[model samples]
Target chain A: MDLTADMTNQPFPTQLFGDDAIDTAEEKAKPSSRQTVGDPFVENPRMICRDVYVYYAEKCAINNVSIDVGRNEVLAMIGPSGCGKSTFLRCLNRMNDTVGTCRVEGDIRLDDMNIYDPSVDVVPLRASVGMVFQKPNPFPKSIFDNVAYGPKIHGLVSNKTELAEIVETSLTKAGLWNEVKDRLHEPGTGLSGGQQQRLCIARAIAVSPEVILMDEPCSALDPIATAKVEELIAELREQFSIVIVTHAMQQAARVSQRTAYFHLGDLIEVGPTDRIFTNPRHQLTEDYITGRFG
Target chain B: MQNTPQQSPITLRINAGLKKRYNTEKRFKRMGISAIVIAMTFLVFLFGSIISNGYTAFQQTYIQLDVSFDQTFFTGENLAAANFPGLVKKTLYSMFPDVTSRNDKKLLTQLVSSNAAFRLMGMVTKDPKLIGTTQKIWVLADDDVDMLIKGHYDRNVAESNRRINDKQLAWIDALAANGKITKKFNTQFFTSGDSREPEQAGIWGATRGSIYTLFIALALSFPIGVAAAIYLEEFAPNNGWTDLIEININNLAAVPSIIFGLLGLAIFINFWGMPRSTPLVGGLVLTLVTLPTIIIAGRAALKSVPPSIREAALGIGASKIQMVTHHVLPLAMPGMLTGTIIGMARALGETAPLLMIGMIAFIVDIPGSVTDPATVLPVQIFLWADSPERAFTEKTSAAIIMLLAFLMLMNGLAVYFRNKFERKW
Candidate 1:
C-alpha cells in the first residue's frame, strides 16, 4: 500500500538515538518482525483484544496489536501523535463504525460475547462500553439531562425520580455533583471546560457500562482540572474498567496500573506502570521514556 | 519584543509604505459605504414611487345625488332589478334642464360610474323604507371622472387624448360647485371582488387566493423537504447514488419555474383531472417549484448543526434516529423553519407557474376553499397591469404594495423564528 511505502520513506525516530541504539533497534524492529514484550493478558479480563488490525481505506492505521482491559482496573495507552493509540482505544467500543472507510479485523470480546460479530448490535454494545472524547463534548442540554440522557435512552429508569437519582449518582461518581448541583437545570455547555468534561464522564457512567473508553479526556482542561480528572480516574477504577489513551506519560503513571506503549501503530511494551516508566524493556519504549525521541 | 527607535532599512521602507496602505484602506471603506448608499437610494426611490402612485387608489371619487326611488319600482318584489340608473340620470338632467341633447344626455350619464346603480340597489335592499324616499346619497364616479378629479389626467391636454371630454368635465365642475362631487375612502377596494370596471375592482379575492395557495404549498413542501433533507444528510450512505441525488436536487432548484408549471399542466390538470384554476393545483405546482429550494436549505441547516453533538448522543448509546431527533433536529429546527418560510415567500410572489396552471384567469369571487378557482396577488397585478383603463395603473401599483407588504410579513416571521429558536452551543 502507499502508506507502507510512505512509512519506509520517512526516517524512524529511533534512528536518531545514535549508532549503538540504532544498530540494535533496527535489527529487532523491522515493521513485520516487531513484537510486544511483557504480558498482554489479564486474569478474568473485562475486554479481550487479540491480533486487532485497523485500516482506513488503503492505509493500515493499526498494525497487529493485542491488549487486555482487566475488570476494575485502569489501562493507559501512551504514545506520540499518529501512533494509533486513540484508534486502538476506539476499537474497544466499536466507535470506529461511524467512519465510513474504516475497517477493523480481529477478535474483540466483551466478557464472553464477541463484540465484532455481525449479529451483535452496536447500540447495546455501546451502552455496555461507553466512551468519553478528547474534547469536552457535553450535549447542548441541561446539566441534569446530560447525565440522564444515557439512562433514558437505554430505558434504565422507569420514573422521573429514578432518573434523577441516577443523574445524581453519576454526577457524584464523576466528582461534579457539588459544583453543578445548583445549576443542574442550566445548559451543560454553560459550564466551565473542566466541569463540562466531568459532565461527559458522568454521562458515560450513567449507563452503568462495565468498561469506559476515554480518549484524552483531560487533554483540553487546565492543570488543576487535569489533576482533578486524574484523581477521578483513580477513584473510578474501583468500579468500572477503563482504557485511556493519553499523550502525557506522567498522567498514565499517575492513574494507570498497567501501561501500554505504542509506536507507529505497533504495541512496543506492556507492563506495570512503575516498571514501564522506570525500567522499560523495549528499546523504543526506553528511548521514549528517556525523552530521546517521542 | 521591544521596539527600537533607531530604524533599520526594513523599518524605514515599511514606514514609507504605511501611508499608502492607510490611503488604500480609506478608499476601500469609502467604496463600501458608497455601495450601501447606492442600494439604499434605489430602495427608497422604489418605495417612494409605489407609495405616491398607489396611495390615491385607497380613496375613490363620489358624486352626491338625490334619488326618488319611485313607487312603481318599489311595488316590485325584486328590488335589485329596478331601474336605479335611470333614477340617478333623471336627477342629473333635472339639475340642468336646458341641456337636452341625446349626445349630451349620454355624456352626462357617463359622469357617474356604471356601478352606481348597483350601489343604490344594495342600499335600498338593505333598507326597504328608503325605496319611496328621495334620499341624498354619495354614489361612485366613473373611472374617467375619478381620474379627472384625482388630477391623474392633464386638463390642458387635447380633448381627444383625455379620457373625460369637455362635456363630462363641465358637468363634474357643476357638481363640484354644488358640493356634490367629493372623494371618500374606497371601502369597495377592500370589501368587494374584482370587476371589469377599474373603479370597482378590489384585491380581497386575490389576497384570499394567495393565502390559500401559500398555505397548501407550505403544508405540503415543508415536511417532505425536511424529511428528505434528514434522510440524505444523516441516514444515507456516502456513495455515488447519494451524490447523484444531491446534484439532482440542486439542479432542480435552478430549473425554470415555468417547467414546473408545464408539469403541473400535464400531470395535475390533464392526468389527475384536478380543477384547472383552483388554489389546490396552483399550490401543488408551487410546491414542486419550492421543494428543491426547501430541501437544499434544510440540508444546509442540518449541516450547520455541530457534529460533536451527534457524536455525544451516539457515545451515550442512543440510536441514530434518536440522536438526530433529540439533539441535531432541535439545533437545526430554527434554520429549517427559516428556510421553509423564505421558500413560502418565494412561492407567494411567483406568477409564471400560476399563469401556466390557468391561475391568471379573471376570477372575481373570493375563494371559499383550496379547490375553488382563484387568482393570486401577482396574477391580479398582472391582469390589472394589462388592462387599457387608466385607473388600472394605480390599481396595479396598489396591488404591488400589498404584495410587498405580504412578502415583508413572511420574511419578518422567518427572522422571528430564526432568532427565537437559535441556540448557542
Candidate 2:
C-alpha cells in the first residue's frame, strides 16, 4: 500500500544528508574499493569482459557487465530466468551472430584476441569454442557417424582407419566408447538420455575444441544423467576450459572451480566456488545463495 | 457426541457449473467424432467409385477369328506381286461364305476395318514361304463384331437403328457354332501397340513411354531437387542468392503445369529442336514441374532436423558443408524421395500439358531415345476418349484403369520409403 507513495516522492540519500554524512558514506565505500584490489581470485583471468552489453531491437537484455573466467577453471553462471547468463555465454563463441537483430557491444576476449572482431570467421570460432545445449541433441544417425562428423568436416583424419581411431578416442574420453563401441552402427537416438549427452560430448571432443560451453546440458536429463554429465564436466576441465550455465545452485557448487553470480543482467560477484557460496561480498549474491531470493 | 456420530459431515464434491462444463466438453468431443466420420465417409465414396468403375478396364474382350490361308490369292508367285488390299478383299469374301450380289460384297467390306487388309497382308508377308501353306490364323475382328461378342450389341434391334443386320448376326452365329470365330481373352491388350481401330489398340506403347519418361524424370529431378534443397537448407548463406533461389523454387512449384508444357515446346522442341512427342521432352517438362515439389518437401525434411544436431557437428569442428552431406542429407532422403515419387505420380496423370507438347497423337514405333517420338498412358487414354467409335469407350476406361494402377504403385512406393527409412530423431 505504501509502494505508490514511496515511488512518487522518493528522496535522494545525498539530498537528505548533510556534508558530514556524505563524507562518512564516501569513507565506507573507499574501504570496500581497497578490499576489491587485494582479491586473489581476480588476478589471473582467462576470459575478461569489460562493460559488455547486448540488445535486441530497443530492449537491453544484458546491461553493462564485467567478469573473468580463470584459466583451467569450471566457472558456473547462475541466475533467474531471463537474467542473461545464457546470453553472456553465447558471447564467448559469438553465437549471437546467428540471430538477426541481436547486437553485442563492449569487449570480450579469449585469452588476448577479441572474439567479436569482424575479421574472425564464425566457423573456426565455433569449432574452437564448442557448445552443448540443454537437450541431448544427438544427430539422427549412427553413433560412429555422429562422433566422426566433426573430425571428417575439418579433415582431422586422412582416411577411414584414422577417422575410426579419432571416433574411438573421443568416445573413450567422453566415457561412452566401451558402452557404445559394439553397437556403433545403431542410431544415436536409440541411446538413453545420459548416453546421448555423453555421445554429444564425444562428438564435441572429436573435433578437439579448446573450450566447451554447457547451457543447462542436464536440464532435460534425469538425475542419474545429470550426475554423470556433472562428473564429465569436472574431468573435462583438465583438457579444456569449461563454462556452464545452470539453474541448480547445488550443481554449480559441486562441479565448478569458480562461480559467477548474475542478477537482472548484472554480474554481482564472482570468486572461488567455496567463497561465493560461503562468503559472498554482494548482498544480492548472498540472498540468492542462501535461498532468501533469486 | 452420539447425535453427532449419527449425522456424518455432508460433503459437496462436484460443482454444478463444472459438471455442466464437463457435459458440454463431452458433447463437443461427440461432435468432433461425427465430423471425422462424415469426412471418412466422403473419402470412402470417392475411392469406391474410382475402384469400381476403373477395375473392369484392366480386363478386355476380343473376337478371335481363325482364317484359312487361301492358296489361290496368297500364291507364292502372286503374293509378291499382289496388293495387300486385294488379299484383304478376298479374305472378307471368305468371311461371308457366299455373297450372291456385288452390293452384298460392298456392304460386307464396310463391316471390316479399312486397315484389316493391311494387317492380313502383314501376316502373309511375314512368312512368304508359308504363302503356299494353308493354316488357321487368329485375327482381331472389326469393332462391330467385337461389340457383338462382348454382349454390347443386340440382334433384335430395329434394322434402321442397328449398325449390323440380323443376317450378319446369323453368319456370326454360324461361325461361332462352327468354332471358326470365338470370343477369347485379349492378351494383346498388354502386348500390342496403339491402332486406329479401337478393338486392336492396347496400352503397351503408352505404358513403355510412361516408364521411360518416369525414368528420366527420376534420374534428373531427384538428384537436382535434393542437391538444391541441401544447399539452400544447409550451406548457402541467407543472402540474396539463396533468397532469390528459394523464391523462384516456390513460385515454380505453383506455376501452371501448362506453362511448363509451353516451355518444353519452345525450348526443347523449337530451340534445342528435340523430337516432337518424345519422352525426353515430356520428361524434361515433368522434371521442371516435379523439381519444385521435391525441393519444397526436401527443405521441410531438412528443417525438421533439430538444430542441436548441427551444433553437435559444429562443436566437433565439422565444416558446414560436411555436416550437411554426411548427416543432414541421409536423414532427409526418405521424405525427399517420397516427394519425388508423388510428383511423378501426378506427372503420370497429366494429359493436357502433354497434349500441348504434341504427345497426344504421335504414333511411335518405340521410345528409342529422348529424341524419339513417344506417347504416354494419359495421352493414349485421351486419344481413345475423343474417338467416335462406340467401342473406344471401353478402351478409354481400360486405359484409365492402367493409369490409376500406375499412380497407386507410385504412392505405394512413397509409403514404403517413408516407413522404411524415416528416422525417429
Candidate 3:
C-alpha cells in the first residue's frame, strides 16, 4: 500500500479507497469499489459525530470515526480491549477531560449544540449525560443516601420529606426499592453485588438525566447480575438515550437497538442490531461477526 | 509382592534425594517456631522491665504538719514590709525550732526544699488571715527526705556520696515515728498543676494543655486537610499546579517537625505576636506538623474510594464538588479520622518542637484560654526530668506515664474510628 499518498493528499476521497486500493492505484488509479450501508435506527439522531479523532500525545486512540446515536435508543459499541470503544463513550460526556494526555479533534454534537464548546458547563452537561462504570460502586453510606445524592445535588428536593420521596421513587424505578426499603439506613456497600449495581442505577435515575453512558457496567458482575443490568438497560431506553460500551457481543445483540462495531480505532460499521448480526455489509464487520478475526 | 521388593532393592530410587530435602524442610519449620518464640520472649521481658521500674513513680509521699502562724512574724507591719524569702525562712524554722543548732540545722534544711519558702509566701499572700491562726498543712518535703521515705536512700553509703546525712535521717525517723510525716497516695500529682518544687508539681497543667491543643489540631486539621485532599484527589485537573501541590504536601510530611515549630515561632509568635508559651501557638505548630499527615492520609482515603463511585455520582449530574462532598468525603472519613488521631498523638509526644516555642516552663495554673501560657505533657516531662532535685526523677516518670496514657487513648480512638466507619466494599 502507498501510505505516502493518504498522508500527503488532503483532498483524497478516503471512502473510495478500499484496504488494497492504494496498492492498485499506483498501477491504474481506477476508482475503488465502494458500497454504502445506512444505519436504520438513525431516523431521529440525538448525537451525531463526524470524523472524530482522539489523540494521546503522539498516538491516535480514535481515528476518523463517524456515527450517530438515536433518540430513546440503546446504542451498543462492541470492540476488543484498546479498540477505542470506551474512549468514544467517555467523549459523549466530556469525561475524557480527566485524562491528562488525551486530546480530541473533529465534530461531536448533541442536538444542535457542540458539547465541547467552551461555554458549556460541565456540571450540567454531566447531569444531562450520566455514566455508569464497570464495577458496582455505591457510596459508603445509607442506601437512601446513595439514591438521594443526585437529587440533593441538583436541588430537586425542597425538604427532607421530598428527598425521601425522590429516593423511594428512584429506587422503585430502578427495581431495587422493594428489597432494600426496610434497610434504607444500612450502608449501601452492605448489599449483594447485583443489588449494589441496581443501587447505582437508582442513584443515576435520581438525578433525572436525559442520557446515560455506561462503560461496561456489567463486566465485573456475575451472569445473573449481568442479566439484571441488561434487563434494566432495555427498560431504561423507554425514557433515556443509552450509550453502552461492551466487550460481550451477545449482550449487545440482546439489549441494544443499534450496534456500532469499532476496530483498530475506527468505526467499521453501524446499523440495526439485528441487521448487523445477520448480514453485515462491511467485510471487517462480517469477519468479526463470523469469528474470522477481531 | 516379594518379587517387587527384590526388584526395588536392585532399582535406583529417583526420589530418594527429594525425600532427604523434605526432611531438611521439616527441620527448618521446627527452627522457625523456636525463633518466633525467642522473639516473643524478648519482647515480653522488655515490657515487664518497663512496667516494674516505672510503676513506683506514680506514687508520692507528703508530711502533714500543724504549722502555727507566728502572729509576731506575720503581722500587718511585717506583711507590708517583710522580705518574702526571709519571712518564709523564719516561718519554716519556727516549725522545726532546731534550724539554728549546727547539727540539727543541716537536718532541718535538708527536710524542706529552698523553693518551699517561695511557695509558702505565695500561700500567705493569698490568705493573710492564716497569719494569726495555726492551721494544719500538707507540705512537700525535700528530694533526699522523699528518697528516704520511698526507699531510694542508701543509708550505708558514705556521707559525702549520699544526698542526705545521718543527722537528716535521724530527723526523718523521728518525724515518721511521731506520725507527723506519713506516706500517702499522691492524688495531687494528677490533679494539680506544675511547680518549681519537684515534690509539688503534677501533670494536670500539661495534660490539660495537650487536650486543648489536640482539640484545636483535630478541629482545624480534619476539615482543612480533608477538603484540600478531596479537591486534589477527586476534582483538581491533572495540571502542573496540582502536581506541584501534591509534591509540596508530601515534602511537608517529611520535613522535621522542629522546622514547623520554627515556622510557627516566626510567623505566629514573632510576627503575629500571639501570646508566647500559649497552647494556641503550640496547637498552631502541631497543626502545621499534622496537616501533612492528615492530608496524606486523607488523600489516601480519597484514593481508596473506587473510581466507580465517582462515576456513579457524575452519571447522576452531580457537580464535581458535589460528588466529592456527598460521596468521596463520607467514604474517606474513617481513614481521615484515623490519620487525625495519629497526628494528635504525635503532637502529644512532641517536646522539642513545643520547647522551641517556649512550652518548657512551669505553668502552675490551668489555662483558661488558648492564649494563656501553657506547657504540654511531654514538655512538662522534659522540664521535670531536667530538674536538679532527686525527687523529680519519679515525677518525670509519672509525667511520662500520663503522656503514654494520652497516646494510648489517641491510638485507641484511631482504631475505633477505623473499625466503626470502615467500608466493607
Candidate 1 residue pairs in clash (backbone atoms < 3 Å): none
Model number with the top TM-score: 1
Of 1 and 3, the candidate ranking higher by lDDT: 1
Q: Tell me the spans in candidate 1 whose CA falls farther than 4 Å from its real position.
A: A1-33, B1-5, B94-99
lDDT of 1 by residue, A1-294 (tens): 243442332222223322233224445343343688755766567787777899999899888887778888899998878999998988888889989899999878887688999999999999999999999999888999899999998899999999999999999999999998988999999999999999999999999999999999999999999999999999999999999999888999999999999999888878788978876767778778778888
List pairs with backbone clashes in candidate 3: A127-B317, A131-B315
lDDT per residue for candidate 1 within B354-406, as digits (tens), equals: 99999999978888999999999999999999999999999999999999999
* All DockQ scores: 0.63, 0.42, 0.51
Q: What is the C-alpha lDDT of each candidate?
A: 0.88, 0.75, 0.77
* TM-score per model over all chains: 0.93, 0.84, 0.82
User: How good is the docking of model 1, as DockQ?
Assistant: 0.63
| Residues A1-294 of candidate 3: C-alpha lDDT, one tens digit per residue | 244532232233434332333222134222121222335224446776767899988899998876767789999998667889999999988888767798988777776567888898787888778778778878877899888887777787799999998899889888888899999999898998888888888887778887888888888889998998899899899999999999888999999988988877877667778977886666666667778776
The sequence of per-residue lDDT tens digits that candidate 2 reaches over residues B1-425 is 23344453442233335678889999999999999999999989866765665444444433333345556675446554566666566666776768768877766665555556666677777776666565565556677877777677777789878877866777677767877665566676787778887766778889988998888888899899888888888767878988898899899988999989998999988999888888888898989989999999999989977676666665555566766876677777787877787788878887767776898865736566666677999889888888988777778777877887888888897888878887776
A1-294 in candidate 2: lDDT tens per residue? 243442232222212212223222224223123112112233445566767899986788888776666667898988788888998898888777656688999887666667888887777777788888788888887899888877767777899999999999999999998899899999899999999999988888777887888899888889998898899888889888889999999999999988887777766666678877876665566667889877
How well does candidate 2 score on lDDT at residue B55? 47
**Candidate 3 chain B lDDT trough over 10 residues, lowest sum:** B1-10
